[model samples]
Target: MTTVLYFGLFAMSFDFISGYTGYLSFGHAAFYGTGAYTVILVANGLVPLFPTSTPFMISLLVGGVFAVVLAVVIGLVSFRLSGVYFAMITLGFAQVLYIFVRGWDYVAANPRDGPSVGGTHPAGFEIGIPGVDQLNLAIGVLAGEEATVLGHTLGSTAVSYYMVGLVALGCYFAMQRILHSPFGRVMLAIRENEERAVAIGYNTYLYKLGAFAISGFFGAIAGGLFAGFRRSATPESSFYFLTTGDALLASIIGGFGTLAGPLYGHLFDETVREFLSKSGQGGGLLPYLRAGLGDQALATPIFGDMTLGVLIDTLLNGHASLYVGIVFVLFVLYVPDGLLGTVRTRVGGTLADAARDRFRDDHSTPERTEGDDE
Candidate 1:
């Protein structure tokens, strides 16, 4: 779930620009990597002038600023083109960064493996109000704080979950607010028809650039949060093009153009992955089947030396990607608008509006008398 929160935020940031502007940022992971590396580097005191004592919140903000700058640099050139060309260019930039980071010794002793939080910073990253010890709460699986309230004790993992959730929720609302603004409407306009938007005297390029920068800022924050919680960042995990691909997959599964849809989509993805995990981390199918079925049934051969358990293990134990891919294809073919988008369409507006209308109809319905039927 913590993975869903931070990665969901990254997906939402991707949707903010790609879904709204119809310009896919195939290399959006560049900003994500930058933010992750920045947080880890700052914590290790390798970043110039920024000491290891720098507050976690400050490091996140600094990373966000860095992402914004990187976005501007990338967008300046990429936005000059449109469609697949733009995507390829952005992807090229990200790939270049990935390779550089993979080989850059300045980043770590073994840059290929990336960096981890060392002796310079041993505590969990704080996530509340900066400079206020009481207001702040540390977040990490093992390094977080634990508290008891009303005889119920919250463990470190639970504390990290709530803190990370709070930040992700805040970022979601901020993006939602932006989506409802005039600037966001312009973004929609550009997506609908760039030529028409240009004809209307709007500098579509600048709007796209601004949107890209904003998205990058949020994307970086998400990366920083991820690094904060894990206490590590890696090139393959953070800078790889597949990182952006994951966000793209979430946006498509959740609902492109619907700001909050990607979170649900990513949650679904994670749920499926965990369920089919080889190690059965979270009560996966393999463990359940093994526990439920006896050894006799499992050992019974259905084919040439392939028993029931062996078949299940071979086909389903760690093949979540196959199932997820099938689901994605079904969604594209039958539910093109995605889960939330289809619901919104059926409701004729947002979920809140639908609920309000239902309430009004229920209250305004005329009362029936005994003779009314006659």
Candidate 2:
């Protein structure tokens, strides 16, 4: 679930630009990688000027700022063209970065494996107010601090979950506010019809550039959070194009234009992935079936050499991608608008608005009609 929150933020950032502006950023992982690498590098004292003692929050902010700058640079050239050409150029840039990072020795002794937090910073990354120790709490699976309230004790994992969740929630609301602003409306206009927006005297190019930068900033923050929690960053995980592909999958499953949809979509994705994982990280199907069915049932053969257990192991174990792909295909064919999107369309307004209207109708006293007076 913590993984879902941070990755969901990344997906939301992707949706902010690609979904709203109708410009796919195939290389969106570039900013994500930039942020992750920045956090790890700063922690390891590999980055110039920024010492190992730099606050985690400050490092995250610096990474986000760097991503914004990189976004502007990429957007300046890519936005000049539209459609697939722009996507390809952005992807090309990310691929180049991926290769460079993979081979760069400055990041770690083995750059291909990326960098991990060493003795320089043994503590978990703090997530609350920067300067106030009381207001801030550390977040990590093993490095986080635990607390006991009433009779219940919260473990380190639980603490990290709540802290990461708080940050993810804050970021979501920030993006939501932006999407409701005039600038966001302009982004929608550009997506709907660029030529029409241009005819109306709006500089679609600049709007796109601004949106891209904002998206990149948030994407980097997501990356920082990920690196903070894992205490490591890898070239394949951070800079690979497939990272952006995962975001795209979440966007499509969640609802491309709806800002919050991606989070729920990613939640669904992670749930399925964990359930079918071979490592049994979350008590996967293989373990469950093995435990539920006795040895007699396990030994029952369905075919010449394959028992039911073997069949289940072969097909369901670690094959989450197959089922997820099927669901994706079904969603594309039948539920094109996506889960939240279809709900919004059916309700004829935002979900919050619909709920408010329903509440008013249910509670408010009906007006006295003329017939009632008679």
Candidate 3:
């Protein structure tokens, strides 16, 4: 769960720029992987060179900073392009990174033994059992002989659930604020019509670069967590361009401009994966689903590629992405607003009705009631 939450943070950050700003960056996985590797590099030899005894908190912060810096570098290079060119360019960069990682025999062959990443933590800092300092706070404290004061330390699942939930919440609110800001207004203008926005004294380049940089920056943070979670940094495992596609799925499947929508999409996809994996198709949802019933009779059809066949039979059971993509296509074609958007529309209608009570006077009430009845 902690792991999922970390990925969610990166996804939310990606959501802010791509989901809200309308740039479909397909290279975010590079940032995510870079961030994870950065954490490993720092936590190991790098920390000792600069400072003494770098703790987990420091590791997390530095990982984020490093990813952001890398994002800036990537943004400056790629945001100048647009449309398919932009997507392709970002992909090219990610591929370049992937190739480098794959070819670097030392990094490639490494066993990925690094500092472990995450675990449990309390929500909001309320010094449980007053007078307890940092030391006593280790493993939480006792409130007059009861360990329940600060609440039980969350399990891995609970921790991840809460962590991801908070980050998602923060991302939603923060993006909402940004969308309502003057800069966000410029983003809207650019999205509506970039040429027109540029003509109206808005520097589209700067706006685009800013959005791209921030989006990549957050994605990198997610990548860093990915490496950290596994305590390994294999070239193939550390970063992959396909991962960015995952983020893109979240953005497109959910309405592009709405904050909560992409998150809903991402959550749905991840949750589905989790469900499928847990079911019996040899550890993958698709394969498990494709398999027959009665006592685990699953079929994993395949093409000629042996590696893919093996991996598919093992991890995917079949083409998980294909199945998921089909679902997305169907959703986009028919239910365009996505899972959350659908819910929001329903909720919006309910809330709108709830808002009418205060506006209704005796005369208006009768008409409103009639309208409601009708």
lDDT of each: 0.89, 0.88, 0.58
Q: Which lDDT tens digits does candidate 1 get at residues 235-263? A: 88899999999998898889998888889
Please tell me which predicted candidate would have the highest TM-score against the true structure.
Answer: 2
Where in model 1 is the C-alpha error above 4 Å? Answer: 109-123, 364-374
Question: Lowest-lDDT window of 10 residues in candidate 1?
Answer: 111-120
Give the lowest summed-lDDT range of ten residues in model 3.
137-146
Please report how far candidate 2 places residue 150 from its true position, in Å.
5.3
List, residue by residue over 1-374, the lDDT tens digit for candidate 2: 78898999999999999999999999999999989889888888878899887888899999999999999999999999999999999999999988887877777746454543323354448888877888777777668778676989888788778888898898889988998999999999999999999999999989999999999999999999888888888888889999999998898888999988888889878887888888767888878988899789989999899998898889887788998999889988998987788889999978999999999999999889889977
Each model's number of backbone clashes?
Answer: 0, 0, 10
lDDT score for candidate 2 against the true structure: 0.88
